[model samples]
Target: MIEILNPAELARAREAGALVAGILQTLRSRSAVGTNLLDIDRWTKDMITEAGAQSCYVDYAPSFGRGPFGHHVCTSVNDAVLHGRPHDYALADGDLLSLDLAVSLGGIVADSAVSFVVGGSEPPESLALISATERALSAGIAAAGPGARTGDVSAAIGAVLGGAGYPVNTQFGGHGVGSTMHQDPHVSNTGRPGRGYPLRPGLLLALEPWVMADTADLVTDADGWTLRSATGCRTAHSEHTIAITDDGAEILTAPERARV
Candidate 1:
């Protein structure tokens, strides 16, 4: 469902967005070499509990995924990209790790994701992949505002990733977020400008730009949740929850210190 949050609801959304952003930053700081995926999940749960917030993923059961995600956060490493279910695995040096998180606070939901190298060794390809997604995310956000079309945001994001020589995957992309995690107005990674849903004030959208190194195909892992590159090539994903305002788009999921 499409929701246009009111003033009070927007305030609650800000709180929820802050919580999600803070938790993601904290998790990124704690994820180091030798850290276990399960440990990250536990840390997420602890923080969510301490903040008196609810996880949008733990009890999530979608048609594409196995019922009940049963995890506090998504820990995607190396080839793994979306819907990465935390498992028993220790991060290694140079491993590309992507953490996707969503949470609800005061009845509003926010979602975000970050991709980074796990250790001292930063592979060139991995760094490039992460940079591309990050740049694309920024482009998408820049294209979003009242009166803008979702296609404009998609086109902007696609230009960045495609210019960087990465294949775009459309199976999953960004979406609207509000009282619930996923909502209407699906935002793809690539599309024609001046097409699709027109943006409006009070609208909240999670703009994510993800790509595989050499292919656009994806394969589900044995776990039935984790989505990996069909070629096993490294992948990266970047996302943020943005609120369309009268003036422009405000990044709700940015770190508190980064917000103006």
Candidate 2:
């Protein structure tokens, strides 16, 4: 379903967006070598509860997933990319970790993700992958605005990732986020511009650009949720929830300080 928030609802969305951003930043700050993935999930739960917010993922049971996702956050490491279920694993130095989170506060939702290297070992390839996804996300956001088609954002995102020599995967990409975690107007990472749904003011979209180092294929891990690169190479993902405004797009999930 596609949703458009009124001014009052948009205000609530900003609050939810800030809460999601702050928690992710805090988790990123606390993440390091030897940090247990379960511990990170626990931290996320605490933060969500303290803020009187609801996790869009903890009990999420979508058709693609095996069952209800019983975790507060997604912790993808190394080859893992999307729907990464938290497990009994400790981060290692040089490991590339990606965290995706969505939460609802005051009846509105915001979703975002960030990928980074653990410890002090920033591998060149890992850094490049992260940079590519981030740049693609920025480009996608820049292309979003009133009257813009979803494909425009997808094309902008694709230009960056494809130009960086990374293959694009359309099976799973960005989507609409609002009263619920996921919604209509599926936003692919790459598509023909001027196609698909036309964007409008008050519409909320979570544009995510993710890429694997060497392959466009994906393999599901034994956990039943984690999506890994078929070639087992490293990967990176970047995302942000933005609202289509009168003039252009407004990033709702930016860091709290960055929002002001």
Candidate 3:
């Protein structure tokens, strides 16, 4: 369903967005060498519960997934990209990890993700992969505004990924988000400009650009939820929740300058 947020609902979205952003950032900072993905999920659940927010993922049982997600946050490490269900693996130095999270607060939902290296190891390939997704996320957010076509955002995001020599998987991308976690107006990572649904004020979307290090083919892990690269190459992802506004796109999940 496509939910158009009224002014009050938009305000609630912003508030929820801020909570999601703060929690993700905090979790990212705390995650390091020796940290287990399941521990991260525990922390995420604790924070969300303490804040009186609801997790959008824990009970999500979509057809694409095997069953209920049963995780508070998605922890994608190394070859794993999207749908990364938290597990028992501990992060190692130089491990490229991505954390994606979403929550419902005050009757609104916000989603975001971030990719970074653990233990300050500057793995060149990992850095490049993460940078590409971040750039692509920026391009997608920049293209979001009232009256803009979803294709415009996809084209902008795809340009960065394609230019960086990464193959994008269309199986999953961005989607409209509001009171519920996922909504209508699917936004592919690549598309022709001036096509698809036209943007309108009050529409909120989570634009995520994720890529595997090599091939676009994905394999489900033994857990039945984690999506990994076919070749086990390292991967990265970047995402943000943005709102279409009368003037332009307002990025609801931008990292705070002070936090950065």
**lDDT (C-alpha) at residue 90 in model 1:** 97
C-alpha TM-score for every candidate: 0.98, 0.98, 0.97
lDDT of 2 by residue, 58-177 (tens): 889988898799999999999999999999999999999999999999999999999999999979999999999999999999999998999999999999999999999999999998
Off by over 4 Å in 2: 257-260
The positional error of residue 98 in candidate 2, measured at the CA in angstroms, is 0.1
Instruction: Put down candidate 3 lDDT per residue, 1-260, tens digits, no spaces.
Output: 89889999998888888888989889988998999998999999999998899999999999889879999999999999988999789999999999999999998999999999999789999999999999999999989898899999999999999999999899999999998898999999999899999999999999999998789999999888999999999999998999999988998887771121
Scored against the true structure, residue 40 in model 1 reaches a CA lDDT of 98
Q: What is the Cα-based lDDT of residue 11 in candidate 1?
A: 91
Q: What TM-score quantifies how close candidate 1 is to the native fold?
A: 0.98
Candidate 3: segments with Cα more than 4 A from true spot: 257-260
Candidate 3 local Cα displacement, residue 71, angstroms: 1.2
Q: Show how many residue pairs clash in every candidate, following the order shown.
A: 0, 0, 0
Residue 92 lDDT (model 1): 97
Evaluation by lDDT, superior candidate among 1 and 3:
1
lDDT of each: 0.94, 0.93, 0.91
